[model samples]
Target: MNPAGSLVESLLPLPVLLPLLGAGAALVLAGRPRVQRWVSVGVLVAVVAISAVLVAGAADRPHVLTVGSWPAPIGITLVADQLSTIMLLTSMTVTLLVLLYAIGQGTSDDETRTPVSIFHPTYLVLAAGVANAFLSGDLFNLYVGFEVLLMASYVLLTLGGTRSRVRAGLTYVVVNVVSSLIFLIGIALVYAAVGTLNLAQISERMAAVDPGTQLAIHLVLLTAFGIKAAVFPLSAWLPDSYPTAAAPVTAVFAGLLTKVGVYSIIRTQTLLFPDDPVAEDILMIAALATMVIGALGAIAQDDVKRVLSFTLVSHIGYMIFGVALATPAGVGAAIFYVVHHITVQATLFCVAGLVERVGGSTSTTRLAGLAAASPLLAVLYFVPAINLGGIPPLSGFIGKLGLVEAGVQDGSVLAWFLVGGAVLTSLLTLYAMAKVWVLAFWRPRDQLPVEHPEDAEFNDLDHEDDPDRRFPVMIGAGRAGSGEESYSGAFLGAARTASDDERVPVALPRGMTVATGTLVAVGLALTLVAGPLYSLTDRAAADLTARTPYVTAVFGQTVDERVTR
Candidate 1:
């Protein structure tokens, strides 16, 4: 191997290995919260640097590592091509930021709520699993990657053992376990049909397989990935499962986990069955459903977290749409969309966490006048919210434009229909975000409606004597009066009596705010570099569609030539 090839190959495993090692070290340092934090942060920072190096090295050709000196088709292999490396770099960057945010919030170190010892290790393990999933070169190894991440996520999700969290975690586990079973079945079927579990080898062998059997295998695998990606009918669990977790946990899960499934779909569809018309059609239909339905669901939501969760589901359809087009332009756009969505979604959730802290709740009815209360927080929320709604001059708009252009170029009936659906979904997303903006940020505290009058009465009684109480106190006092007239009057009276300044800002944790602001800034920065990024993804799509580059790099020769030799 050339010197450059050797160096790139050496780095392939570190994105996975470093995190696992860090997790173990974090476990040993369980009693030392400060040391654990340093170890975790240092490890992710290293992974990010390594992933950046790999992205540069793998731009022209893939770097493949055969585990334990064994050759391809026999031993475990890890491949870092343009697609995987891009994903690794982007995911690690976001993971690092989210970790910082978590540290700032002390979510992982609070013993009374989450066990300080378990949180760091479990989080590192989750990072390893995401890296492993992106790099695995075999179906079984990919399955291992999924299991590793899922297991770690199970721990992370139930960290507090709150009844709501535990219940949500249970639902997450059952859904993922079933998905894993289906994935295993699909892997078994692939190996049974081809006598090898190596992905490159499977791709090579699948060409001669019976068409009916190919269709069956394809459907089974897509079903499993669909569930994982939270595509439409398969996505009900996501909105329910994600919102109940802690903010940092929800942020990371919202950003990375579903993208892994989408990445798998992109990999398999292009490599294994690039010409499968039926599957492509099915994917197109699924993409449209996921988009429209998720947007509508987002519109119905009143909680900030739940609204973000539904939007997460909705935007996933954009990525799927790119993949379903089955063109280099389409797939390239999908890849870009994934990158854009990961950063934006995570940023919004982090902002939601901040909102919860400032407002005392995420409910629209309870949150009001946040624009005046914390202009900084309002800017943080609004920037990403509009970006997510596909506002122009942002990464979100760039990505959606790419997909819409690709759909137009395809010029098929279904493609046109999806184009219309994509536009509609974008508008609906804007509407949902605008609604949140008006109710949660714009409306005055005194003008806010009370959802549960009884709860408001209880709150009023609970904090009657507390002089320094914040917005909730105002709400409760407002609701204690006779009716709307009395309620509004009392609310305004309390606000005036409490302070002459109505805009006295609630103090937010500086560390958490800085971390979230940094992430939001990163999301905005994507627009500046969208051109080079999209170009990279386009080349990646070309290679994926060609398939030869990946397979040849895997075995150090074309699969056919290697077989003949």
Candidate 2:
């Protein structure tokens, strides 16, 4: 422990606490949509501010808070290490942007509920859950954080009540629930084996245990978290469900959820079971399969959102590759990669929503001529698409380069294998993005058609009892633009009357431009600040590798002997 340093603390609880309190307020004010929006934004603003303070504090000193001050290993603790502080900051930024976007989107317009007030409270809870997960120092605390957000997510995913959405949501719910159960069971076994749920204590205890039992627990915990992370074989449910949600919901979910899983993997690997060869070996194999199979699925998907969702799965392998390397440089690269990927993925999803809004259908088959139709949007899609594909100068390329460099330095067969797999995945990612670009943006507009009038009527007819039946009208209008596409009689009438707003000539209501623009600005901020941002990430990575700060913060003392990795 660095006893020479002064203890640092602040009113850091605002990040999570404000959101929780605001959520209750929002639920109480459910009848007032405007009030709900304001409340959600205010909560997010406070969260973002608190996160900034934490990040700044982490730059100077590690910030630790014991909930009830029982002591290390017994009391619940929240430690703002550099990695977690950065995650908190990024989560707040994304959440704020999404909330603004949703505001402009209007709650009544959401397909899920007539009064969109539940979104405010649920989203706050979800954000708070994420902050809690990132900051928690105890294994049991992490479990509670996961449960907190998962319950909210179950509702968010099933927001709209269409048959496809309901079906997809059900699958998502079942898979996540089963994974959560496994996680609880794993926690129980770990506690039984080690006598404590404190992460540092578990790390200390694991060294004294027999290798076989340690290996069994390591594999069990990995399997549970692997499912949460959507690793190869356990990842089938992500693609089936993520694409069906509302765009804002999908964007937030995509940004935060899998990363939470990856965060768990990072925590467990570094803290709980650092030297388990079986776990390392499993990660190596799983990283390859996840990257390959996920990319293949992206290649085969016609839906633009679905393609991106599969690509998200593919990219998770990259982070797993870093964890598998088990080196300072590798871990650093993984942390950097996580922030870059989260922002990039969320931005891409937000843009996908825009694409669907502007071009009518997100299906590659139905989308065309976006480049000519709305060049600004085309720019939006292109830059992030290229970033996701690991083009030079973008953060994605920088992150991947660091990982590959670390792999070369490690010089193990497994590390080399992961490097090769990463390269292949990058190529596949490029191919997938190019497929989207070619099919949706480069094609002539005449090849695509707006929705048929009969189909429009059918959609309305089929979902008449549904809360979101009105959305098809707006969605149909998003499809009306581009070059020479013709619409059915009914669709043409609806499309012509949709809107005169040059920003969105489709089905979207005139009021949403502000919201869409807000989220877009969030993406822009990351790109504009990439220089200073990467520096922060690099420093955070360095701190994350220096294990003493975190250990001392949690336990108030550190062991003299260095633990073997």
Candidate 2 residue lDDT tens string, 252-302: 888899999999898888777777777888898998899888998999987
- Per-prediction TM-score to the true structure, in the order listed: 0.92, 0.88
Question: Global CA lDDT of candidate 1, please?
Answer: 0.86
Q: lDDT of each structure?
A: 0.86, 0.75
lDDT over C-alpha atoms for residue 376 of model 1:
92
Q: What is the lDDT of residue 186 in candidate 1?
A: 98
Those runs of model 2 whose alpha carbons end farther than 4 Å from true positions after fitting are 1-8, 107-112, 449-504, 507-535, 560-565
How close is each model in CA RMSD to the real structure? 6.3, 5.3
Best candidate according to lDDT = 1
Range of the 10 consecutive residues with the lowest summed lDDT in candidate 1:
472-481
